[model samples]
Target chain A: MTDLRKSDRLIKLGLLMIAFSAISALFVITLFIFEQGGPIMFKYGLKSFIFGQDWYPSEKIFGLWPMIVGSLMVTLGALIIGVPLGLATAIFLAEFSSRRLARILKPVIELLAGIPSVVYGFLGLMFLIPFIRENLGGPGLSVLAASIILGIMILPTVISISLDSIRAVPDCYREGSIALGATRWQTVRMVVLPAARSGILAAIILGMGRAIGETMAVIMVAGNAAEIPSSILQPVRTLTSNIALEMGYAAGEHRQALFATGVILFVIIMVLNTIANLTASRQGKR
Target chain B: MKETAIEVRNLNHFYNRHQSLKNINLEVYRHEILAIIGPAKSGKSTFLTCLNRMSDLIPGARVEGQILIDGQDIYRPEVDVVALRRKFGMVFATPIPLPMSIYENVVYGVRLAGKNNRPELDRLVEDSLEKAGLWNEVKDRLRISALKLSGGQQQRLCLARILALKPEYILLDEPTSGLDPISTMKIEDSLRRLKQNYTIILVTNNTKQAARVADRTAFFLMGELVEVAETEIIFTRPTDKRTEAYLEGKFG
Candidate 1:
């Protein structure tokens, strides 16, 4: 009995230590980032850093308006293109497609997600950029190219999350709707989609975050211009790619400004994550 | 001499290669409660689902049967399955109200069928809730989510959803199995009143419930219909020894 009690105490202590260590690691990372970036942000004033669009290292002037706008435009474009296709694919997989077709398609979608973002960027650069340049009459790298590539990259996430949500609905719900004289598509649109609304929203928000934070792919195709473009065909610079491209060479005040951009990007991602978490909980409650 | 509401002829069903229901024949009279009683997996639920074509919803399920609703063959290729289902609604064992407000849950079927006028929807919601015996309790809280209701109220709300469709026939698969005694009694009372206008086919393992509410009772064993007779006869002096043994608690 004494031996068992000793072992139990030891296990409890081990678990406590593990939990404390995990939490402390997270706290340490957060503190380190805040300690490095907070003073610079306060000195510059958060509003000017956010609203000022001019980002010139030589003149020591940095603003994020263009970067923020570029991120929004690209993410919105991706959502516009990806959401309907993802929803359609999810509905087909969940409701209409035969088992064999679903079996074949689901793995293909997973594979699409598994392909490295760099590979996608390379593919976009080689084929899609040239196609746009030849056909649409613009430079190879543009916001349109970045948006198209990001949309494809995020398609798998949207389809997978929406499919899981739709599948999570009870079989009885479908039967109930069908028993009410709803055709297959009608049941999907009226019953299944509404029931999976929060989950679908969560999926879209996650995709939006991915589109906004994506760096390497956007860097390869977005042309890295620090100006808000008038059309999709023009070049732009997202906050993530701007930070990645200049962070290594930047020093002193310039580096602090780059870290400030990192801080802003971090805030945006945090907000997106909070929204995703809220919707996820709402789905659970439903 | 009563007008038949449903006619089942040479019905057989199989789950994959396993036969779950054998050749069966029966007729359900209009405005009467017909109860199906059986041991677990004796194909009672299967038979009830076949009446409304719900048995075929699952993949790898096959049915060899002819079910006629009002002299029209439901199994015929030209018949619209959706329309057939709309005319014959179902209630499952567990309460499954849609994830919406109480009023929306009640009128979901109507809206699905394209009735969107607010006053018409309100009337149907009130009438269905009243018929299901839930209006008095939920009328004030109609805007609240349906899932917030008690288990019994959720079951009744499901009933109201079906009732809103104004189906000629209602198939209930153990509608009261999950309810407390009082809620069970409420459901039974609602069914009693509902049978004045709609035919009801109920499947249950609760023989006492069958005796209490069913006008007629059918006993099933090993996917076969053992006997069907008036509820009193089936309980008090059944012709089939299997039913007698079951009712006597000898062995299932």
Candidate 2:
């Protein structure tokens, strides 16, 4: 018994060490990014660094307002294109389809997520860009192309999570609604959807995170033009694209500015994740 | 003896070929409480669900029967299931207060039926809650979450939810199996009052409950109903040997 207790204690300590190591790594990375980027923001002045549009690194004009707008536009476009299709697919998989069909479709949809980001970028560049150019009358590589690619990339994430949440609703709610004379569609709309509301909202926020943080695919189709786009057809640049494009040759304050962009992306993701957590916890309490 | 509210003839039910309810026939009279008592897996719940066609929700559950409510076949292909369900409301063993307020829970059925006038809904909510014996306790907090109520109150709220539909027939499956004795008696009292206006069919594990509130009682065993008779006759002078054995607690 003593031997067993000693071994258990050693194993418990080892696991605790591993857990804290992972958490401390996150803290270290956060500290490093802020440290590297903080001085640059101060030297450039916070307003000029964030809101100035000109991004000519050679001239030391580091205004990133256009990239901020670009990120927002692309993310919004992805949601507009992805949410309806993803939610419909989730509802079909969870509520309407046979178990055999859902079993077949769910894994195939999840397989889309395993395809490398570069592969998606290549496909978007080769096919979608040209298609958009021919049909919509802008440069082939434009905000529209990036948004479409990112939207497709996030479909698996949105559908799988939403499907899980929708399926999590208890059968009692459905039975109760149906027993009260509500049709199947009416039951789904009035009862199941409300019960699964928080989870679905969390899924959408997660998808938004994916859309905002995606780098390679957005870069390939987004033209990487440092300008605020006036329409969906125009070329644009995102913060992720900005870092990826300039990080290789950047030195001195230029490198620090790239780190500052990473800091901003990190903060955005943290905020999204916090909201997702709160939504999930509120659902748990209910 | 009285006008039949429901008649089941030559009924059988199967879940993926494992028969759960064998050939059974029963009749429920208007404005009468018919209690079905049996051990677990005796098909009492299945028989109750069949009356209102709630069994249709279970995938792979196949039923072949003629269940006539007011002499109209409920399982007919062209029957309007929604309309049929509106006429026959069901409450399950577990209390499922929709994740909404108390007032909303009572008016949920009425709203689905397209009655949206606020004053009309207010009156219906009060009447239903009172019929369920919950209005006096929850009248001031009708806007609060139904889930925040005690287990007994939640169960009564579920009863109110069904009452709001003003159904002609009310089917309850072990409605008090999860409740304390006081709560059970409160529901029994409500059922006694409710019987004046609606036909009630109760499936329960408690034999004494059947004795206390049921006008007639049916005994079931292993997917077959052994006998059904007046509650007094079934308790004191059961005719079937199996029903006698069950009432004596000799074997399940």
Q: What DockQ, on C-alphas, does every prediction get?
A: 0.60, 0.68
For candidate 2, write residues A34-143 as lDDT tens digits.
99988898899989989898998888889889998899889989988888889989999898899999999999999999999999999998999989999988898888
Residue B140, model 2, lDDT: 98
**What tens-digit string does per-residue lDDT give for candidate 2 at B1-252?**
599888989899999979988889998899999999989999999998787788888889999989988788889999888898898878889988888899998998899989999999999999999999999999999998888998889989989998999999899999999999999999999999999999999999999999999999999898898999999999999999889888888876
Candidate 1 is scored at a TM of: 0.93
Per-residue alpha-carbon lDDT of candidate 1 for residues A1-286, written as tens digits (9 for 90 to 100):
9999999999999999999999999888777767777777778788878898787876877778899899888988888888888888998998989989999999899899888889989999899999999999778688899999999888999999999999999888888778777787877887789888878988898888889988998999888899998789998899899889998898898887877777777888888789778877877675
What i-RMS does every model get? 1.6, 1.4
Task: Tell me the spans in candidate 2 whose CA falls farther than 4 Å from its real position.
Answer: A1-5, A275-286
What CAPRI grade goes to candidate 2?
medium
Each prediction's TM-score against the native? Answer: 0.93, 0.96
Give the chain B TM-score for each candidate.
Answer: 0.98, 0.98
What are the per-residue Cα lDDT tens digits for candidate 1 across B19-71?
99998989899999999998999999989878778776888899997888889
